[model samples]
Target: MNGYHILLVEDDSMIGDLLQKMLVREGYQVTWEKDGENVLDIIHQIDLVIMDIMLPGEDGYQVTKKIKNAGLNIPIIFLSARNDIDSKLQGLTIGEDYMIKPFDPRELLLRMKKMLENQYGTFTQIKHVFIDAEHKKVFHRSLHQEVAFTAIERKIFFYLYENRDRTLTKEHFFDYLWQLEDRNPNIVNVHIKKIREKIHDHTGEIIQNIYGEGYRLNTHMKK
Candidate 1:
């Protein structure tokens, strides 16, 4: 499971039901509510929100303001039928994004994923490991224990993760870990060896050695 929870505040039964099902199918936990009522009661449990502008009582904008006023930093995307520029502007100003009704579900889903990743960092399960960029930690899926790392190892791991798929040179690590201090390039190799061992990547599968380039974290590993 993706393991992120979403709060869907949509009054239309058909739309809410369809969205809830799609989100669930995409491996997200969803809480569907018809209106803004009872939002605060369970807002803490929500990781992100899909809001509707028109509702039985308080509108999405008002509800969003209240949530923000309460010092919550949850990301929200306004989904509504209103296509007017004014409505879109207001929604965009208050929420992270705005999607008009009759929108493509695929696009909406993609946006949700990007927003979640941007806000909470890259969280994905790949094979036996769960990389939680937000927490700066990795967990063994079956063992149910965190993959411990040294301070410098953790920094290097996350730096590679945050820049996944892009080969980071040895100089990048030296600059990141100790600025202006020339350190042995082999030190990076040593730390990477331990990191790979801890994460069970003995064959350089996930953390690939790019020949003469450097190292890269390939997060697209099959689950």
Candidate 2:
């Protein structure tokens, strides 16, 4: 956890800086590359890669192919703005995960943790619902394609998944995600509603509102 080295391939200075800072805070050594050229040069030192799709000269797909062709086995997570199914499918074939842009910091952290631990095993199976944490995606057979979730939605889903048996109050999420003790916590309600709709947990919403005590993932939910 502390000594892990990650090569970050992102061209946008602002996004790259924020991601680097967050990963460093989580105790990982990050060697950031703006373009796709130097990635091959430094892949030997990296334990995992968090790459952006739209890079300088070469896109993520090309760079990933190069790395794989060279026989460097590494977990690559694609963090890009391309939310299309085609893009997701193609990236997933080469990389470990394909995350859409405007991602939650916590989701990225969790995926990175999972990818780093992939040598041991993957996350526990949650039935049909595939939590593509590395990709920051969530989907099931009911939805033929991936259900896009915003940064907040991913945070909510991941939190509920981790603590599936427990009820989480709005204040809990507000404090944990937003890192603030807010005055109006109804925004949490809005997010919960959206997550339910996107994932298609209608009659028995996977996220059940506790009427008075916030919400929790319904244990009765399908496998």
Candidate 3:
């Protein structure tokens, strides 16, 4: 939730400064661009985009087409003063959400939070560890370090994180690892052991081992 990078494309200095300050204070890393230039250069790193219709060069709609054509699925929100029906329809057609100028900052924050949750899912925290499943990254808040995982370890952890609180059978993991040459059921145990060690869940508190069931990433350990 804290590390979401946002691209704010607005030419108005007043609005851009206000939004940049607000977004940063709300725990977002923001990049303010006066126009549609250099979007593709950093599009992959951007989690969401706040676009303004009126700009110095290519309009918001045109920039949106470039983004879409680049094959990236980054969500865009149009924040423009043009609140007419035609503009709204056009904005909503290409962008995910459209908001008019002179809008409430609080409402914008709420809408942004909702949109981000819907797009990338809310973060899952287990003890001092925070899981960003969509971005495939985990951070240890206590130590202020990213928890590294091997490719297989990351896959297994992601699977468990995606289905947190649900019991995923060994067969589920086996089916997941079907493509691997070594489809041994014990591989799940090995990877889970490594994952638990990396996350410092030595007592199986975060990743629980059900006696009859398979395994479940217990969200109750978040406390």
Candidate 4:
């Protein structure tokens, strides 16, 4: 919910700024692009793209076509002023979705959510025992306990959840905590212990150590 990254490509300054602000207000991390040329630079980092049909350098169709051809598979929804059948067909055929200009902002948000849900697993479905990335909080229903994380703790849990597919070494956590070359890797152990305590995971260590391999989250993404 909070961490979904969206790419907004619109040439017009006014429209682009407005759309970016709206998307941000809705909790999406919006990356604004003024031209189609810059799409490639941020495409790999974004979850979705909301583009204008008429771009300055390269048109929306051309940019989307290139993205699809590249097999990047990032879903794109065209937000254009061109209200023509041919335009709709071409954009839909080349991209994942399309939406006309002068449309409701709420509807745009809903479509973005749908595209994201279809692409990645739903946020609610992927919850850990007490880790809720969507709401950016932690809670346990059975124990009737809910505790919030500090900024650093939240980052640690989020990173662990995202990379739960494999064991995460202490070095991986050290890199996230500080840019300082002198930061000690032992700090990872301290924080990991704190996270375990806060979540009341005393009996079962959900994020268990993998012996020589560091650590891994013993949780699976719910289908």
Tell me the whole-model lDDT of each prediction, alpha carbons only.
0.88, 0.79, 0.86, 0.76
Predicted model with the maximum lDDT: 1
For candidate 1, lDDT tens digit of each residue in 106-132? 999999989988887775676667788
List TM-scores for all candidates, in order.
Answer: 0.62, 0.54, 0.65, 0.59
Candidate 3 or 2, higher lDDT = 3
Clashing residue pairs, backbone N/CA/C < 3 A, model 4: none
**Tens digit of per-residue lDDT, candidate 3, span 119-165:** 87777667767787768988765213678888888888889888989
Report the C-alpha displacement of residue 90, candidate 4, in angstroms.
0.3
Query: Model 4 residue 45 lDDT?
Result: 74
Q: Give the clashing residue pairs of candidate 1, or none.
A: none
TM-score of 3: 0.65
lDDT of 4 by residue, 63-125 (tens): 988888888988899988888999999989988888888999889888888888788645432
lDDT of 2 by residue, 141-179 (tens): 322246788877888888887788799987778777887
Alpha-carbon lDDT of model 1: 0.88
Q: Between which residue pairs do clashes occur in model 2?
A: 98-135, 99-135
Compute the lDDT of residue 171 as modeled in candidate 1.
88
Model 4 residue 47 distance off true place after TM-score fit, in angstroms: 0.1
